[model samples]
Target: MNPGVADAALEGGSAPVGPRRGRLGRPSWPLTILMIAASLTVLVPLYFTIVMAFKSPAQIGSGSGLEFPSPIVWDNFARAWEMVGFGRSLMVTALITVFSVAGAIVVCSMVAYAIARNWHRRAYKVAYIYLLSGLFVPFTVLILPLIKLTAMLGIDGPVGVTLIHIVGGIAFNSLLYIAFLRSIPLELEESARIDGATTWQVFWRVIFPLLGPMNATVGIFAFLGAWNDFLLPQMMIANPELQTLPVVQQLFQGEFNTEYNLAFASYLMAMVPTLIAFVFAQKWVMSGVMRGAIK
Candidate 1:
């Protein structure tokens, strides 16, 4: 055999074989396409809303829903702000959301910590079951009774709403906290206890501080729920002056008529705060969720 041919044969024989291909080896073009389509489907309404929000009533009425504003109307936001009572409602919503989230975090975290630490005890296990039982009960089921109770207590405004949110949120938030707490090493807590720290001191100084991601996750969820909630506020609060953003924005629509551009503008305005919140807390939210899932 020729030397060149022998060398070529040897090189070919020694060449690596690639890993065998299976279904997963092929690119999922169909799934990718479907996801893109789904994304666009969800985004189209948002795009249209943003466009309409920037448009004047005349422009919105005359132009295609999908079309961008010809001349962006900055006054739409100002007008929508006034129409929606954005100043007062924003304050109300912010107050309710802040208090509700803070209260839920403090109360739920404490409850979950207690349950997690005493999980082996029959009494604590029963308490955990009782707390978690709230998850199975729908808010709708208690609406009428809740409204009556709130009215009877004379706390039918933002205060009542905030209280309701804090209470209603405890179940899910406790669940997340419990899961995350289980992932925490017992030694850290034991060490703190050994150092003459009381249970509350150890929790606040050590365990609570370590719950940053979970706290952010819980806060985001609580804020979203409190901020976007309309039913509880609507049923409990009849005074237009005391209504939250969602409730007040509903007043912009009539049974037979609607202000399309103004409504979109109000909605756009209402969305800004929550969107900003999500943008800031998205990292923590993702991290917390992954950790919770892993635990």
Candidate 2:
């Protein structure tokens, strides 16, 4: 055949295959498609919630359920805030979250440091087991006991709720921290000790900074728990004034006058602090989790 005829034949025919053609070896169009489908499956609910949050009552009320709002109502947030007393609730929740998380981090860190480094005896082990027992004992089982205990202790308001969180959270939080602490190089602490650093100084200056990522990881989780905690606050605090954001946000939907649009907005509002905390702590948080997992 002529060169031009051969070239034309090659062009008309398919290009020669470069590699093996099995599902594992070949370009996996099916697998890629499956992964994309799975991702959308997971993200669709988040997408739906975000879109619904931005929609108007008229749009939600229309029963389309999936369509965008005509007006794109932004004032639903303000209405939600007022109807729910969201500001006051947020303040109370923030106070509780900040204090509880800080307290948990401090107390848990100290306990973890002791258990991780200094001592590992039956006494410490038994005490740790007693703390960890909280994880097995469901909060539902303890509700009555806790009610009576709180009444006896005169710890019945937001303060009571914070204390409850600290108690409830201690076991898991301290375990994670202590597990991570075991991974820290003893040489660092030893060198600090040689330099005449006191126990508190060594903890505050050296070990503490090294634990930054883990601390942030623990803190964001603790904070979000406290910020979004509904049951403890609702059960412990009878005064409407003491209600948290989650409990207060519930006010938007009553036996009557169920404000779905405002309810969605309030839900979004409740997410704001957690969102912010994640944004700021993402790097360290992820690193800490990976480090802990490795250890």
Candidate 3:
């Protein structure tokens, strides 16, 4: 091909890929502006939350929530902690989150492993499809039915809420595990079986170890979902003393009145654990997503 023709052809071929960039290889201004605007939607609220949490009641009333407090007040956190019974709620939330994450990982991984290995069979294929159907069902639609079912089972408390979280996550978590499991070669399990390993032994000794990245990814998601959940705990937990932190934080709100400082402080506190978990495990999440996507 002629050099000039080749250059023109290459440029023309790539032209439809995306919007054109501006001078100096910068992205188009419209795209940059749109991204900035989208980012502000999150950043602005985060800024307000931090500022409001530190502000005194008088300061909160004197200005819009944008300004930093002249003298930051630690009392809001102290009051929010006491009013919400933060210690008890935190312990309950942690127990539910830990149980939910562990249960989801073990149960979903086993189910996905079974389904993935037997995918060519009719029964497993049907079972996989049946589970995947759950992804489309909205939680709101199940709430009323779940309320009745839990009451009947005598689990209308934190235990019921924990069970719901684990069960609810099976569809999505199994999907991730199944996808990642596809990328793992059957030779590994075969080698284990050749060493006189049983089916359960093969899975435990060979397959489960290899799912570390996907497990981290799933566990992080499960932790966040269980820890931050409010609706399920509020509706399902019969005893008011057993509510999770997110549900307990409702103390700061009233029909006609709100405690901005206390509410923001409580929210900030609840958000910290999630932020820490994501920060530490973010790389595993990315790697797991890429591995899952590959097969």
> Evaluated with TM-score, which candidate comes out highest?
1
Candidate structures ordered by TM-score, highest first: 1, 3, 2
Candidate 2 per-residue lDDT, tens place, 1-295, comes to 4757644543333222223334375567999999999999856766666667778766787775666666788888898788778888888998999899898889989888877775558778777788888789899998888878887888788888998888888888888888768769999988999999999999999888888767866786777678888888988886888799888866766788656878888888887777776678665555544443333
Candidate 3 structure quality by residue, lDDT tens digits, 63-166:
97799886898998998899888889999999999999999999999999999999999999999999999999999999999999999999999999999999
Q: In candidate 3, which residue pairs clash?
A: none
Candidate 1 residue spans exceeding 4 A from truth: 1-34, 255-258, 289-295
TM-score of each: 0.82, 0.78, 0.81
- Per-residue CA lDDT of model 1 for 52-91, tens digit only, reads 8888777877867789887888888888888778899899
Give Cα-based local distance difference scores for all models. 0.82, 0.78, 0.85
- Looking at candidate 2, the ten consecutive residues that score lowest on lDDT are 11-20
Model 2: residues with Cα > 4 Å off, grouped in runs: 1-32, 54-56, 120-122, 276-283, 287-295
Worst 10 residues of 1 by lDDT: 12-21
- Largest lDDT belongs to which candidate? 3
Clashing pairs in 1: none
Clash total of candidate 2: 0
What is the clash count for each candidate, in the order shown?
0, 0, 0
For all the candidates, what are their Cα RMSDs to the real structure? 11.8, 13.0, 7.3
